[model samples]
Target: MLLSLRGVSKSFGAVHALQDVDLDVLAGKVTALVGDNGAGKSTLVKTVAGTWQPTSGEIFWKDQRTSIRTPRDADALGIATVYQDLALCDNLDIVQNMFLGHERLRFRLLDENAMERAARGTLAELSVTTVRSVRQLVASLSGGQRQSVAVARAVMRDAQLVIMDEPTAALGVSQTAQVLALIRTLADRGIGVLLISHNLNDVFSVADRIAVLYLGRLVHSGDVAGYTPQRVVEIITTGTLATAAT
Candidate 1:
């Protein structure tokens, strides 16, 4: 397993966001995390991203018990999160956005050629071909292209596990397909992808595994073949498979 959560729990005063949640994400596969609103999906992501610490329980990275005390810690562990907001600057070009914080500097000067080459290389490796030029400002790109840039930036950072939150939200059919293909490409390249989405069609089409969350608990987790769309919906709403199975 690339990442594992054991008996992970989170509480806010009298409310519990997660309860003894145990889950595993394997390398080179996409695990789709499905849930209704307030199902502790965000809480779980935040905990793993180090935005908030778990109230209890343990997190394991590559079988080593670890504590992700901050976002930097998560990044150091080769974990990258791409939230709904792409977090890209509109004024910046692709190379700048990809190397924003970690720029290539040589002899106290910005090595623009090096950064540009690396950015283009990463995008090409990911099979992203829609953008006119890496020099194009982010504000001019389509929604899907912008998403591609964000994902490419994560890839360029050498992230082993990428946590994507609602990556296909607000995209058109073609754009969704494009992003889905990119996701598959990520898994093909031996990177673990934790995809959090409400779209069952997307999940069934792209995910190798499915984990359903209800009332802050992971009700079911197994191979994608083991779950039907109806069963997933039932679990998300009712937190049980008895009726759906029957």
Candidate 2:
């Protein structure tokens, strides 16, 4: 496993956001994290991303036991989380946005040439072909194009594990398809992808593994071929289904 949470739990005073949850994300594969509202999906993702430290748990990266105490710690481990908003600057162009805070510098100034070349290379690596140029402003890009840029930024930073939250939530059919293909391309490049999504179609479309969280606990985790949409819905609502493999 590339990343795994063992007996993980998080609490806000008396409210237990996650309880004894365990999940594994393997390299070169997409693991879908799914659940209903308040089902601990966000909490788990935040915990793994180091935004929120687990109240009690162990985070294993690359099979060694470790701790994610902060976002920087997670980044040091090559883990990047791309939320639904994408957290992009609308005024910035693609190259600038890709190297926003971590800009390359040859002397005391920004290395525009190197940054542009690297951004273009990362986008090409992801097979992104929508944008006309890397100099285009982010605000002018489409939803899928913006998403592709956000993901490409992560790849540019050499993120080994990319955890995306609802990457295609607001996209149209074609845009959604585009993002899904890009996700598959990411896994094809041997990156571990943990996709948190509410849409089952999107999940089944790109995920190799599925891990279901229900009310602060993991109810199921297995291959995508093992569960149908109806079965997934059943587990999400009731915490269990007759066909659930546990």
Candidate 3:
């Protein structure tokens, strides 16, 4: 496993957002995390992304137990999260946004050429060819194009594990397909992806594994081959298979 969580739990006062969750993500594979609203999906992603430390749990990276107490820590461990909002700077161009904080420098000056080359190369490698140019402003790009830029930036940063939250939300059918293809490209290049989404069609399209959460607990997790859309719906609704749902 590239990343693993054991006996993980999180709490806010009397509310338990996650309870004894165990999950694993492998390099070069996509793991889809599915659940209904308020099923602790956001809580789990936030905890893993370093937005919040777990109340009690163990996180292992490549089998070594460690604590991610800050976003920097997560970055140092090669973990990058692209939240639903994407956190892109609309005013900046694709290259600028990609190298926003980590801009290249030469002789006490910004290395625009270097950054542009790197950004363009990363996008090309990921097969994001819809953009006219890396110099184009992010605001002018379509929804799926913006998503492609966000993912390209993460790849340029050498992210080993990318956790995406609702990546295909609110996208048109064609745009959604584009983003889903990009996700598959990530896994093909040996990057681990943890995709949090409510869309079953999208999940079934690219995920090699699936983990289902319900009411702060992980109800089911395994290879995608073992689950059907119906079984997943039942688990999300009643925390069990339909045959077992009472």
What is the lDDT of every predicted structure here?
A: 0.95, 0.94, 0.94
Task: Give the alpha carbon lDDT tens digit for every residue of 2-88 in model 2.
Answer: 998999999999999999998999999999999999999999989988899999988899999999989999999999999899999
Better of 1 and 2 by TM-score: 1
True-vs-predicted CA distance for residue 133, candidate 3, Å: 1.0
Candidate 1 ranges beyond 4 A from true positions: 244-246
Evaluated at residue 66, the lDDT of candidate 1 is 97
Give the candidate order by descending lDDT.
1, 2, 3
lDDT of 3 by residue, 139-200 (tens): 99999999999999899999999999999997999999999999999999999999999999
Kindly list the per-residue Cα lDDT of model 1 for residues 1-246, writing each as its tens digit: 999999999999989999999999999999999999999999999999999999999999999999999999999999999999999999999899999999999998999999999999999999999988999999999989999999999999999999999999989999999999999999999999999999999999999999998988988899999878988988899899777353
How far residue 23's Cα lies from its native spot in candidate 3, in Å, is: 0.5
Segments of candidate 2 deviating more than 4 angstroms: 243-246
TM-score for every candidate vs. truth?
Answer: 0.98, 0.98, 0.98
Compared with the true structure, the alpha-carbon lDDT of candidate 1 equals: 0.95
